[model samples]
Target: MSPWTMPLVSAAVLLLTGAVLVALWLWVNRQSWTDQEKRTLAQLEVVKVASGIALGGGGLFTLYLAARRQRTQEEAQADINADAEARRITELYTKAVQQLGDDKAPVRLGGLYALERLGQQQPDQRQTIVNVLCAYLRMPYTPPPERAARSAKGVHRPLLRNSGRRAGIRRPEGQSPAAGLVDAQQERDVRLTAQRILVAHLKRGGESWGELDINLDGAVLIDFRVSDGLFRAATFRGATFIGDMYFLGIFTGFVSFAGASFVDEANFGGTFRGVTRFSEVFFGGEVAFSGVSFAGYVTSFAGASFAADAIFGETEFVGRTHFRDSAFSGRAGFASAWVGESAIEPGSSWPAGWTVSGEATSRPGRDGHDGQWFRLVRTSSAAPPRPPTARS
Candidate 1:
């Protein structure tokens, strides 16, 4: 109510009371009541009316202040609770990461699981946990040398040998496997487990994490698979694939494989939905993309080299695919490959030893007239010519 409302109402009530009292006084005066007694009664009534108005207004204002104060206290308590909860989550995350640094493989595995659980429980921590896991995978580790010679192995064996020597010296016995040193087999298992965890979370649906950016630069991976998965961004720059690698993932963001080496066979049967780069990549063994699709705006393979047969049979290039200055050391097959109004320039960068299949070529004969040599033509043609039929 307005400040003047209460005062006005009180004054009206007082006037009515005074009028009634005066009428009573008139009647009483006609009787035996004295004028001084009526005056005393009127003064007492005025004092009571003033006191009631003051008390009622004061009570309402006090209640309003109390209610506001209670609300403020509740908000403050809630803020404090949120802060404490955040602190607790941070502590848990720290403990789990610390466990990953433990020397024992089992302990490290436990730490991975803990981080995984934490990420699942806290959606905000998912990307951080993923980074931690990738960092672990990116760390250097030596697999035991399969051969007697230490340098012949593909895995990191120097770290293992040093660890063993340190353990041997510390042992009370003459020489023994070092304490807290993971053996080659155990180390391999750990690496495989890490790979599995990464792949499992990247799959679609069923607790799978989406829109993750993976950076595995200079990491050593073996028999890796990214089939039927989705990623925000993926980079394997300078990475070494020890065994066969299958890259069939769908990239929604930037992707790179510059300077990456595929030691064994690699199959890039994937779909690119964004910018993609594969410059200076080396495929040591055979590589095939029989049904792959490159649909990104920019797909580059500048300076990439293929040692063995590189097949692109039936591959679809729906976007700009560049292979500028790339070397094909072996047969480069593009039989039945489709370039649907897209840009794909396979220039004359092949090595002298390289030969392209399904190309129509011609060389001069002893005769003055021009003579046809090979049945395929090599040019920067976006649309592939009709593939020659196979001989019976």
Candidate 2:
């Protein structure tokens, strides 16, 4: 009940109780009193009852009003405090983002840490901060000039500079890193730190792992390691890996690497639970997918080029695995690779020149090299004398 209503009701009850008492007294004394005496007793009774009821009711009403006023004041103060806190958080966020564009590497690192703290404190800002870090990584970056000169033609160029043995960061004014003069080693350190931040937070059951998607298109990852990691939907389209790229023991959401280039040896020995696309990707070094499993709805490698040996030993495909129009300059191996029931329909997306020799189980060749796999195995001729093996 409302404060005002309770006091008013109490007053009404008091008045009624006084009236009832007066009536009872009059009825009891009617037989032993004269009319004047009865009138005097009734008048005195009414005065006394009225005074008591007035005082009690007025006191209760006053108390209720006071309490209501105090509560209102407290609520108003709480709102003001909340507004001030929100403004403080906003100011902090703005300052951190501004520091990300500073020329000094140390300042940029500080900004990254500040944003990370903000995300940890505020769950709603975690994904946004992660996106900012990814954006920084995606900025046009290349290896040092000395390393770039050693790379082959059409490779992703390197642009980051190095001051000394220690690393730093350089994000000049504007969005692009083209005009930014970066120390190669220092820039690599900053990028590594940024990657570490994401890795630390994106783990399962982590305090800051939200349902977020990672997009690192056109990023330059020199010698990074994402092995044994768990990620949500992610895309590294058009990204370049300068050194050995290890994707072993990784469990990921829908993944994509369309047009990505791996300069050195690449290992994809992991399990992909969602769609895995690698269309138009170029593998410059030896690629090993041994013991890899693709349970995704669709796994495609259309138009991919393998300049070195491509190994798929013991790889299992639980769903569609496509390799249409793919080129392998070196020997390709798919020995002991199984096609589960979900992907029984073989040769659906194979190259036109390749053929499947076994309907159910493919046997190894005389030298234990050539094995008839489920669908796609590209040999120089229609059926070569000696085909590649698991060890090839």
Best by lDDT: 2
lDDT of 2 by residue, 69-144 (tens): 9999999999999899789778888899898888777888898899889988988777788889999999987656
TM-score of model 2 (CA atoms): 0.68
lDDT of 1 at 295: 67
lDDT of 1: 0.69
Off by over 4 Å in 1: 1-67, 146-182, 342-392
Overall lDDT per candidate, in order of appearance: 0.69, 0.72
